[model samples]
Structure formats: C-alpha cells, structure tokens
Target: MAGGRIADQVGRVLGGRYRLVAPIGTGGSAHVYVADDTTLRRRVAVKVLQPALALDQAFLKRFRAESQAAAALNHPNIMRVFDWGEDAEGPFLVMEFLEGGSLRDMLDSGRRLTVSQAVLVGLEAARALDYAHRRGLVHRDIKPANICFDDEGRSAIADFGLARALAEAAWTEPDGVLLGTARYAAPEAAQGRNVDGKADVYALGWVLLEAVTGDAPPVADTTVATLMARANQPIVAPFGV
Candidate 1:
C-alpha cells in the first residue's frame, strides 16, 4: 500500500499545521498517522483517505459518516475527533492520540485477560455504546480492530466509520451493501435492514467471546441471499462463558 517516498511521508506537513511523524495503522480506506499539531502543540492521530478511496464517491460518503457521527459525540470512552479537512495528500480526519495500541494486539498476543479485567473492558466499551445508542446511533462495526485502549489499559471504541443514525438509516447504497465487518455484524445488518442499539450489543458479545476463547469467528462468504438467510439461523456457541 505504500509507494516509494509515499511511504516516507513522515516528515510532511499537512494543512500548514499538522506534521506527520510516523505511520500508526491503516483501515480499508485510510492510512492513520501520528502527527504533531503544530498550531495546538499536541500530538494527534490523522486518518487520511487513500487516493483510491478519496476518488470514489461512495467511499467519500462513508468517510463523511464517521466524521459527522464522531464529531457529534463527546463521551470519554469514544475516540474524540478534533478536526478534519483536506490536504494535498487527501481528505483527513484528525483525532486524539492514544498510545496503548489496539485490543486486536492484546488478543493476538495469546494472553487472555483475567475475568475482572475482561469485565472492566466490556463495561467501559458498553458504556460508550450505550451513550451513543441513547442518541440514536448504531455502530455497525464492532470487531477487535476497532477497539483500542487508553494509557491505563482502559477500553475505548474507535472508528465509528460504519455508524448509522436511526432516523435516516441508510443501510444500503443503490447497489447491494453490507455495511459492517461480516464476522461481527448483526444479522439484520447483513440483510441491509435498519439496525438499532441491539446490533451493537450483539457485536460486543462476540468481542467478549473472542477475548475469553482466543478464537476468531468464522465468516461464511457474504452474499445477499446468504447474509439475509443468517437472520433466520441460530448461532451455536462452542463453549459457555
């Protein structure tokens, strides 16, 4: 995904204030950078859309979804978005920088959290979701990759990119659309139906299950018919918590 010097964009300055320091991570459509906000004199995470994604009208719409939803939220467990604007590279969303890395890292290390630790993480993340849900937002994506930690190892939910509001719920585009990560998605979501707070709660159950089991959920090939059919199916858990 990184081109020659494009990979070396660490020293570049964006929007005349944010200076890129290093690459932090990447998503389906953006590369995240830890940048110094020269104007504010603090470090921030910058999520810049890839050139290919920036050029797609559809991706731009989804990008705007996260920016708008996150900008409206002000909860402690939810990642805070400070500012967003386009630079020469592409459109970027500026957010607070958290150093504790992601929950995916924790899970991948093969070290399971104690029962109490896992409970605490689940509580904090659930609070974040409850806060947003009360305000009519459904965070469609809730896999490990989107759950990060704070300096004290507290769980925080990031990347509300697939979040959809209840009133104007647009579950699908003109063509068929499955808005979230298939493995964690609620059945209604895969069927392109309006999902409520229940969908997020369901996803959290999967997150916690993986935390204790060290197993990734299996994903069947996602097709319109199959995805919708999953709605009528019952999921059998491998083990009891």
Candidate 2:
C-alpha cells in the first residue's frame, strides 16, 4: 500500500514538463512511469526513487552521483538519461522510453539467441560498457535484465553508470544488500572489494555465457552462498563458445 501510494503519481507533473501517465515498471528503489513530456510533446520514462531512499542523505548523494554519471554519457547502446528532479514525493529521473522489453524477458519465454545472434547483441552492449569505462564509469550491474531493446530490435545497456549509486542506496535496506544480482555478479563485487570497469566486463561475460547456453546461472538461496560461488568458483565457458 505504501509503495502504491507513492507510485500513484499517475497524473502528477514533474519539472513542470513531464506528466506521469502510468506505472511502467518498478525496482527495489525506484518506480518507473511512462510519462508525457509536455514541453516536447513526446513520451519519456520517469524513474522516481522510492520515498525512503530519496530521503536518506547518504543514498541521495550516491543517487545524484549516479544520475550525473549516466547523464554524461552518449552511446547508441546505452540507455539515455534526459533529466532529473525532486519533488515532495522524492527524487526522479527522466530517460528515453524504450518499446521492446528486456533481454531477460525474451530468455524467460524460451527465446535464447544463437551464438552468432547473441554476438550482435553482445557487441552493442560491449560498446556501451567500453564507452563508460573510457569515461571512468562502471556499470557494476550487467545482466540480461539490464539489457533492453528498442522497437527496432536494437540492444542497449540500461542503468549504464548508476549501479554503484543504486547499489549503495539498496545497502540501507533493513538487511544489508549486495551491489548487484548474485547470478551475474563479478568476483570482486561479490567480495565487497573495490571494483572497476573489469567488474562490468566480468558480469557481461557471464551474461553472454547464459545467452548462448540457454542456462540460467545458479542463484543461491542466500546472498552469502552466491557471493562464495562467484568469488571461489571459476565460471565454465558457455557451450559452443
């Protein structure tokens, strides 16, 4: 009920320009709305940070930092951030509204791409990551869920440079949290050690492995076990890769 109330900003206007039209998606710390850009007269996505995380001083810092990092990048294969703002409800970010669903959705529906097919998707994703790495930013989260497409079947990396900030906000949850999903987490990230672009590279590698094999990596019941596996086990190469 609480989350629903906050997310019910269906008709609210943000930045005096974007009007929230409907709830499109939700994440641990944010609610995504398909909104109308009144000024541009176009559709856009507005991701509002849940009230609690928005109110937390530490999380807000990371939030702004991540927003800034993502907004600074321009790549064909990265989700494009347009603007950000705060209101009585909390902080929100604006981004391009994509039409095609996530890669994860396709895989769950038994639509695994062939190795050659996945290579094209992988190349686009890799290009986005490389662009961020060159700019001193890291995606921190690289999974099929974060890989989205457009109406044209083009793939792009979502939350390209904000994983750190979002992960940091999630850390303040009642129980602590890991920065990214364990199934695709990099070894250093699973260990809570300092990480860099290489972490994203590692996670991307795992994602591609799953893409080719049509096998979802084992996600342990406990975060601890997941961490142990990523940190201790050497990943098997994808079949036929």
Candidate 3:
C-alpha cells in the first residue's frame, strides 16, 4: 500500500510545526507521514502513534522516555530522531527522511539482494547495533521493516526503542497479538527470557539470510507456534553462503 493516504491527516499540521504532506507508510503500531519541518525548512518523516496507544498514559510515558534516549543516539547506520512530542492529535516523532525505502519494501517487491549487497547491509546494521548496545541500549525490534536506506543506498536501523517501550505499556490487546514480528524474533525473546545484544544479532542474522535467500526463517501458523518452532532450533544456512 503506497502511502496508505489519509485525507484528513494529509493537510493537517502537528505541533504547529510539521505540515503533513503525504502518508508514506503504515505499520501495525502507527502510520508514517512525510511532512515538512517548517522550522527546519526541510522534509522529515513523522510517525504518529495509534490513537489507542496514545490513550494509554503509561505507554505514553514509557514511549516518551524511550524516544528521548533514542534521540540521543548518533551513528551513521542509525536513523536520526530529531524531536518528539504530543499534540492534539497524539504522540509523534520527527525523523530524518530516508528516500531509498526499506529492506522490507525491497523484499516485498520480489527482489533479493546479492551476497555482496547483503553483507554490506548486514555490516552497517551490526555496527549500529553494537554502538547502541555498548551504551546500554538494546533494540528489541530488529526486522526488515525497521532497516531503512538512504538516498545513497546506505542502510540504517530505525525505531530504536519502540518495542521495549511498548512492552512496558499497559495497553490491552488481543491474546494473540505479539509486540514484535515473530519470524524475526530471537530465541530468548520468543521464550520470554531476558534479552541482551545477542537478540539483536540473532534477528539481524535472520534478516541477512532472508536478504540473500528471499525467504523468512520458517514459521508456523499461529504467533505462539511460530515462536516455539524456532525457539531452540538452530538456523541452517543454505548451500553456498
């Protein structure tokens, strides 16, 4: 769904600064818009939290704290978060605009990266994760959709602390709803154990494998089943990797 255009939000302005130009993407938690940062005189991507999440005071508080931490991260492979705040509409984050799309977008379009390309992307992502990990920040969510590319095809990790913030929230959901993507989840994450930087490494391995093979790690029908299927099992690489 290109842009997933929302007419009402298309012309709306947030925080009396960002003018929503067009919807760029929609995810399970929020809808992203390409907006004009009037103060900065530049384009930016604004991610507005879902209304249901906005209503949860606890979630909003955790989210605010996480966004603040993420905003302080500075690295070439990490997407830059400029500002975050709540307005009449809801909570929103201002981020650097990436024009090269995402790894998820490339895969969805039926394109598989060559081995060399996958390795390069993986290296950049690993560097970003390492930088964050050393500073006591673990990215609880690492998936194709969270890896965005810039105009020059440089990959950067996005949505740094969103999953952890969400997990801390008191928002209610259907029993089967999972906080992050099951297919890319690490074993410790799936088993409800404490996760460190290794979880991010595991997920990135899966992402790199998918990049070269054009397939997600095997998963079952249900969220529980999917997580259990890969929990303790080792991921087998295809021949010639």
Residue-pair clash count for candidate 1: 0
Candidate 2 residue spans exceeding 4 A from truth: 1-7, 170-180, 237-241
214-239, model 1: which lDDT tens digit per residue?
76655565545446655777766767
Query: Model 3 clash tally?
Result: 0
User: What lDDT does the true structure give each of the candidates?
Assistant: 0.74, 0.79, 0.85
Candidate of highest TM-score: 3
Which sections of candidate 1 miss by over 4 Å?
A: 3-6, 57-66, 161-180, 221-229
Best by lDDT: 3
Worst 10 residues of 3 by lDDT: 171-180
RMSD to the native, candidate 3? Answer: 2.5
Between prediction 1 and prediction 3, the one with superior lDDT is: 3
Model 3 CA lDDT for position 14: 92
Q: Give each model a TM-score.
A: 0.84, 0.89, 0.92
> What lDDT, from 0 to 1, does candidate 1 have?
0.74
Model 3 per-residue lDDT tens digits across residues 1-241 = 1243364688888988999998888776678999999998999999987667778888888888889999999999999999998866668899989999999899999998999999899999999999999999999889899999999999999999888877876664343445338888888888999999999999999899989898777767777887887787776776666
Q: Model 2 Cα displacement at 132 (Å)?
A: 0.9
For candidate 2, write residues 63-128 as lDDT tens digits: 787888898898989989998888777788899888887888888788888888788988898888
